[model samples]
Target chain A: MSSDVKRLSLILLFSPFALWIVLLILLPHIGMVALSLREKVAPRVYEFGFGNYIDFINEPIYWNTLLRTGSMSLLVTALALLIGFPVAYYIAKIAGKRSRGALFLMCLIPLWVSDLIRAFGWILLLRETGVISSFLIWTGMTDHGIEFLYNDVTVIIGLVYTVILFMIVPLVSTLDGMGDDMIEAGYNLGGNSLTVLRRIIIPYAMPGIVAGCIVVFMLTAGSYLTPILLGGKNSSWFTEQIYDQFITRFNWESGAAFGFLLLAFTSFVVWLGLRLSGQSLTNTVART
Target chain B: MARANTSKALLFGYQAYIVAFFVFLAAPLVAAGTFAFNDSLFPSLPWQGFTLDWFFNDTEPKLGMFHDRRLLRGLYYSFVIALMVSTLSVAVGTTNAFLFVRREFPYKNFFYILMIVPLVIPGVILGISILVLASNVANTADDRFGIELEFLRPGLFLVVLGQFSFITTITSLVITARLRKCDLSLEEAAYNLGAGRARVLFTITLPFLRPAMIASGIVAFLVSFENFNTTLFLVGSESPLTITMYDRMAKVGSTPVLNAVSFFLMVGSGLLALISVVVQRPAPSE
Candidate 1:
């Protein structure tokens, strides 16, 4: 193809994608940032300032819920890593080829299901009159029925269950790529199993660990259905606040500000995670 | 001998831990599936007699999910939106994948990072941002052009647009992975044989990408169909199945029919996943 023809074909093939990214993703976010900076004074009157962001700072509930959501998401990420590492190790390193495929599929099935239905599943298991409560009553572990839903513990459980697969898939891929000889070498060098795990295995799996944490943290923080359904009346999830502002209260300015703040906060957390793990964002996403 | 025994014990412990984890992961789904058949009003346990009322009952005091018109309409809308989103996403994503993987352009790194911003951003935020943008566009069109873009109004069209924004990125990533692994020598050979560019692309390149396209299409469909967080903001009067389910669960609490719906969704998605696995399975000789 000639130079002109090559350039024309490139434009023809690429403009639709470029148009999509610029029009949908970039413009909307830019509009949101613009909206976030301005404060609505009356029905149609608006003034450009940091008033929306300042409102968030002045409101204790907003910042408090923000911090709570972040810390809880971090806790969920940690719990998922703790639970996922062993299962990933088994599937990647120990299981036979056929069984490994089956195990991975088993983990993936729940991921494909809707998050709403999964939250409902937890309700069936943990609600006041649900299966576990009944079981506990039958076993004489509790008097009458105990309410297991509508609490922070239930919210954490639901969040972890919802995001565990994100952790496992990445960890499995990373661990699967590792050579078993590395571990054997550590043992040969008089290193105990825990030492080998800490020194050799964890470092080798750092990319996957970082990738999983990023995904889990984002999902847990942004989740709305799981926290609301499982946490019930007293949820106070930050996403719920965003939902209330935009949908319930019809305050798009404040909602947009909260949305931008969430994006900033999650990005910062991801950066900190990558920095602490010594893995770059490009490396982590490429691994995924 | 002592070291071997210790290792054996450790292996046993690991096996037990994996078993427990599997049970924990699966128990909720199993519980939901079982109670779908329970002949009672509540989804929770009371050892009610087994019945299919929730699935097929059309009588008074026992309406099946399938028999409910609203739920059925929600399901229909969900399928329609998912179909449109997947088709659009696949078309745009496939082209973008080729653009990124096959050819280099200026500002490619900048654009690449911008494209991924939607994926990491929260769905709630994405929904609100799109909602704000679309409304702004609608207002502009009405004021300047004296025309109303019906698609920009909150409905299936906006839902498709909102979902397409992020889902296209996912599809592009899947196709890019396949494209990277694909052998380039075949394309070069085809071109060397005097095959036209279009011919080489259709016969050599597209054939190699068919599997990834199909897999990504399935993923895009599922993501759009089950989407609630983003669709909630974009939906006007036409609610998807997820939104309807959320409303019912929150308002009326748990019902047997809800369980039935959950069971059906599980089975449908499970079958789709199984088919994808089967399609991707290696040939027997290999």
Candidate 2:
């Protein structure tokens, strides 16, 4: 009797959570796919077909937007890699115990902010008479105030500012577990530092590097707020197009197709990341 | 030894660059926090005279900068919704964390992978799903059950549900990461000490898990509070604080008060994280 009661109680606890996920997370994704195939008419009837995919393909702006978004994602991913690798190395390799926690907290602060507010700050920084321009004028970098906002350059910088932490956390955690012994051995064997890095450090952190790149890519690709706020109308990205289709034009079909394609793309990147590392994100980083 | 010295020089040089890079990475938050007290509303050129008026403008008659009624309301709603979602996520997350950590179950990998799909899936799709499902269920409830469930409407409860969908996965991941190293020997010791199974878990193990639980809970809260993509879809015009701010910004680009609000929020989140870090009890590791 006690066993049955415990079983009943456990089921009661687990079922609601499971049901919530199935209904919200799993089933809704199914609905997105369904919504993609279904054509919405005047009186709330969705006629189901492959018309949406066809329309999506027929749209050049959509493909162009996807390409632009993809490249933007790549740009940010590359910059974050260029920017994050050494910091992770330093934190994992050099920082004292007392300061490491504080350093980690610094990496996390920007991450915890609202992306909207973060983007707004970029707008505030990059605008025609904004912070960067004012600084330029003060330092006499330019004869007149400069306008940096609403361009690809600002968008790239904004995306980098937002998504860099996704790169750092994984990289630092991965690198932290790897000791200095191998590098020391390499040096002992008369290999130079550059040689050691290219030959050993890169390979050691490859999994984390790959996982971090994938995460940064997915975030930059799926990002709407940064590009929307900073990218301006001329700086059109795929997510911006998706937003237009759904909210402005009231079209769900093409929007769903666009959304699904983005999903498939990110899923492919994640799968590729898993394949690259042959491990989960946790282990890929510094082998914790 | 000479080779080590040469390599050490090189690594230190690289570390110098890294220190600079970290400073660059941390610039924005510090900048935003700095300008929160700026007398100037905009981030214009020339360090506009600094003042604490932005923090104290709540008293003026014609739009007190500091005492923004709308902004404060939004912040309050954000806190409430975040707290609710965090609690919900932690509750569910703890269950899944327990399941994954403690015992072998049927199709364990399947359930594990199945549970974390939302983590990788775009928040955009996740948002759409919650919107459709909640509305559909609400529709059916009104039709069949003759009960209009306002809580399930596109508001607080629905927002919590949407945020919790993915937030639980994060909380679960963090807790599970800690749980794998929870040293089941402790539980075994408790079991041997004339304690019941529940007693062993609650008395012996739960304290050990508290730090992770608290950290994950607070993180889940922050994620929900800042969440925009999902909330955008499900918020139904008057949803929560972030939604309200977004709507205003989207329509009219909002006021400088928003900057004040954002600054305050960033400070609030920073303090929460700092306190969490400090209050975190050091659990003896395995």
Candidate 3:
């Protein structure tokens, strides 16, 4: 192709990408930051300031929920990793080839459904008049049905259930690439299974672990439907505060501020997680 | 011998743990699916005989999803929105695949990182940011020129835009992966055979990308259909099925009708997922 033709083609190809990145992702976020930096001085009037962010710190409920949401998300990420690592290991290393494909498909089935449906499913099992409570009554474990929903534990469980597949996919892919001979070598060098795992497997899967943790943590922290539906009145999720600012109270200024606060929190934690795991974003992105 | 025996025990324990994990994963969905056919109105308790009333009944109290006008309309709206979002996303995604793979530019790595930002940020924040910017533009337009940009307001149009924003990033990733795997030699061979650039692109390049485009289209469709967090903010008067179902679950708690709807959604999405997987697999040799 001629240089002119090549340049034309390049520009044509680049236009859509440039438009999408600038108009959709870049500008909207910039607008959000700008909106957040302003203060509502009077009716239909505003001034640029940090008053919105200051409000977040001054209000105990706001900061408390932010901390709670952050901590809870960390807890959920840890739980997902703990639960997902073993299952991923089994799928990647232990299962026969045919069963490996089938097991991986089973892991992915939950993701086909929406988070709302999953939360609905949890409600069916954990609600006051739900299946597990009824089963417990039939088994004579308790005299009355227990409302298992609307607690921190329930929210954490729901979050873990929703995000475990994300954790497992990266884990399985990374673990699948690891050679079995390495494990045997570790065992041959006077190492037990635990030692082999600690030495040979976890180190090899560090990129996948970091990748999974970033995704699960982001999803957990940003989640809205699971916490609200499962936790109900006591949800106190930071996303709920943002929702109240925009939809309930119609305070767009503060809503934008809260949104940026959340983005910052998630970004900081993700950076911290990558540092601790000794993996960079490029490595995690490549593995996933 | 003792170490071997302990390893066997550990293997048994690992197998049992996997079984328990699968149970934990499958239990909630299974419970929800089971109660859809229960004879009772409530979604729990007594071994009520099987009935498809929740799927078929058009009564005052036991309104089925198929017969309910509002629910069906919501489903239709979701379908239309998903259709628009997927088409736009796939079209843009194809160009994105070409740009990222075949071309070189300054700040390419920076742009790539920017592309991933939409995926990582909270969906609600995405919704809110778009809402803020769009509305600000709309207000400015109305104030200065006395013009009404209805599309910028919180409506179905905004909903489609909100979903398309992030979903395009996903489709781009899928197509980019497929494009990276394409053999440039084949395109060179096409060019050597006296084919023009456009002709080569149409006949050789696009056909190679057909499966990926279809797969990403299916993914984009499913993501848009099931979206709630972004849709919740951008929805105007007309709500989609997810928002409608969310409202119902919040209000009525556990109704068998909702379970019936969940069953259908699960089956529908499962079939789409199956098709996408099948399409992405390489065709068998004769």
lDDT score, candidate 2, position A89: 78
Better of 2 and 3 by lDDT: 3
Model 1, residue A42: displacement in angstroms? 2.8
Ordered list by lDDT, greatest first: 3, 1, 2
lDDT of 3 by residue, B1-286 (tens): 9989998999999999999999999998888788899898788878699998999988969888799887898899999999999999999999998988999989988877777767777898889989988998999999999999999999999999999999998899889988998999999999889899889999999999999999999999999999988889899978999998888877777688888988998899889988888888888961
Model 2 has an lDDT value of 0.76
Residue-level lDDT tens digits of model 2 in B1-286: 9988987898788877867777666565555556665666554445667666766755553244446666667777888889999998888888877777764557767767777666767777676666766666788999999999887777777777888888888888878877887887888788778898778878877877788899888889899999988777677535567777777678866345566667888878888788677656464672
Please report the candidate that would top lDDT against the real structure: 3
Q: For each candidate, give its TM-score against the true structure.
A: 0.97, 0.91, 0.97
Q: Best candidate per DockQ, number? A: 3
In terms of TM-score, how similar is model 1 to the real structure?
Answer: 0.97
Each prediction's interface RMSD?
1.2, 2.8, 1.2
Q: In candidate 3, which residue pairs get closer than 3 Å at backbone N, Cα or C atoms, i.e. clash? A: none
- Give stretches of model 2 more than 4 Å off: A1-17, A41-43, A276-288, B1-16, B59-62, B140-148, B251-255, B279-286
**Colliding pairs, model 1:** none
Over A168-223, each residue of candidate 3 has an lDDT whose tens digit, in order, gives 99999999999999999998899987898898899999989988988889989999
DockQ of each model vs. true complex: 0.76, 0.50, 0.76
